[model samples]
Target: MLWTLRSPSVRHLQPCLARKLSFTPNSRLPRITKDAVREIPPSTSFREQVARSAAPKSFTSEIKTPPVRNQVIVFLVGSFAVYSIAAEQCNVETAKWTKKLSGSSLIWKVREPTSEELRKAKRLELGRKLQAGLSSLKDMTEGWSQTMRGLAVWSYIQVFQPILDAGDGKRTCWAIGGVNTLVWAAWQVPKFQPFMMKHFAHNPLSGISYTLLTSMFSHRSFLHLLFNCMALASFGKSSGVAASVHLMKEQAKNPHGIQETDVTWHFLAFYMSAGLFSGMTSHVMTSKVLYPRMIARLTSKAKPVDAAAVAKTSETITETSEKTILPSLGASGAIYAAVTLTALAFPHTEIALMIPPSFPIPIQWGVGGIVALDVIGALRGWRFFDHWAHLGGAAFGAWYYNYGPHMWNSVRATHLEASQKVQRPEKTD
Candidate 1:
């Protein structure tokens, strides 16, 4: 007996089948995805339903080639990147993680992570580590510049708060203060510096170093201030301020605390170290054949500019030749460190760059990529930007973070010792 076929299209339908059904010639479903199908009940007219829904999901099919997942990917990445860079550039904290639930028990039923979710989480974890590493690098920044940086940051925040709340002169504006903060940070650099220096000096006894912490108020220009203020409107204007104040209070309590004294020392250290590391890395690569003395010599004279300048001069440098090079300026060193910090803090977070934000990169990968790039820069001594500074700052940030808890403990112990000494009767002269 011969059985009659219901419809060849039903069994024969693959994503390849969508091609014949699709109206446009070069466009059809590429994957035979299960998501395209709904219910396939026994009583239902399954064949006709599949044909109808199988029609491409379109917003305006005739007018355009309809949006695809690729478009969605691009949009998500681009928007995320712009927000990330803008927020980071201005020193505001940006979003990076999503709330998630994970577990193995059905009785304790947990939300299973989708592929995108898992991918993002892994990226976030990686970013967090790198960012911490960057914080360790601040140890390398010079004192005055770091203080200037703090002032600039605070000023931007102050401007930002008021601007955010001004609300086109209508709604109760939250961003107004942030705008004010930026304005203050930009114009009042000198005033903030004295305060910065007074508060952040290093310990004489504990081998602890110090630098001014008011870099909270520095900005490169009016544009920098303006943009930072705008960003402060969205994120709370008080983030870095709170951190700075807390450090200051702690310093007052424990003179040997982690913040710093000789406000220019750490910043200067970072600047020189970055250049030095960059030069050393570069020398090692070119020298090919290893010599320990040569490496140490290169490292000792490692100013960022000399690292760059050394390439043109003879690779050989005597001790006498190192003294003449000029020192560099700018917050780029610490900024690079901060960039890495934000990247690691929110690795799963997305980033969109300025100039061209066609897409966003995952924060974790972004941090890795930038750090990797900096490493390559150190070795090659690229002239584009100070890759060594970036690496140096990142390294400093990580070190500081690791030492943060321990440093605080040391400060507390010193405080206790001093307090007991104060309570004890003074010896008569």
Candidate 2:
């Protein structure tokens, strides 16, 4: 009777078996079927084959084994590619409500508004005013024509056109435009003024948590919005290019491999959190040091100035929260974060300032100079801008550049492993 051994090491025991045993029909062994006792194939390493087949096929394996450098590259590259794609896909119409679920859908999607027959929208004066204008067919047609004309004018005036490859989806321009449009509208609309003041501007003492997010998009000044958008467009686009190059190189190695949305989430998380922390930094500095000093100075020097005026100033400062509460309203903090990140990601890239058109500076040097200026500004009590916020944002960008990718990968791996465990139960021997 013939028998087959399923062990991969069985081949190693062949000599021992040959010397000790002789197979005979009289031997009391169960016969192995011809199909089960097939001859070993020639020119094959059974051990290697078995090892490859039994290897873990989990995504965690893919993530956990990569070098630290590669992990960063993968994350940064993946994020850049996704950002390019996501930005290109989103438009003004969809951007208002199109949601991106951080790690899963790096892409933006508008949710279908649920039809609730039970509840009706409250009709306020503004809603009635908006509806009143659209009642007449002639007025509607005129409004439509005016809107088309305005769009044409906007298209003509747009400084940054769709120069990106169509495949990438020219979405960044829209985001920049949308932000600028909102800032412009806020200045023009009386009703929007209070909304902008409450939500768009960050006040540390306000106790509203969401101001951190909204403040990043709010700029009360036209110049502030214009300059920030310009910087974001230039540096952000350059950073995206660097990331894309890195991604393409990786894709070249494993053409069939799938990528995650980790990069997109990383960039976005880094951006938003940087803004929040930066704003908090400013708040800390002001509340702990700057505000206290101001109060002390006002109390101590009250006699030097016009006594009545000083008294009035001191009373005004004491009575109203506005004087004590410094409201920061701008995208400077977030833009600074992007600038520092871009400098780190592509240090050799040349940066040119609009003021000095003839001179070009290394990105790293430029970032260093900007950081130094912020430090000086912060120390000297320069209140022209939120220097503390700038420092905070820059610090975050540098830190994130160094360690963010590895941390991100580790988190993703942990999440994936947990999910795999939930979906697949281990078998018992």
Off by over 4 Å in 1: 1-327, 423-429
Model 2, TM vs. native: 0.54
Reference-based lDDT, residue 83, model 1: 33
Best by lDDT: 2
In TM-score terms, which candidate is top? 2
lDDT of 2 by residue, 1-429 (tens): 999878768889888878845466555777888876577555659887787786555321222211223223333454455444433322211222222222224232243321110001111323455445434433445556777856654553353233322111123434654776677677678888887888777775565555656777777777777787777666545234333223223322332222332123334545556666677667667666776665565455444457688567756756554564577877677678777877877778887789447588788898899899999999988878899999988987777667655544444445545555777978999
For candidate 1, the TM-score is 0.31
Against the hidden reference, what TM-scores do the models get? 0.31, 0.54
Candidate 1 on 305-348: residue-level lDDT in tens?
55457554334433322221212222344444434444544446
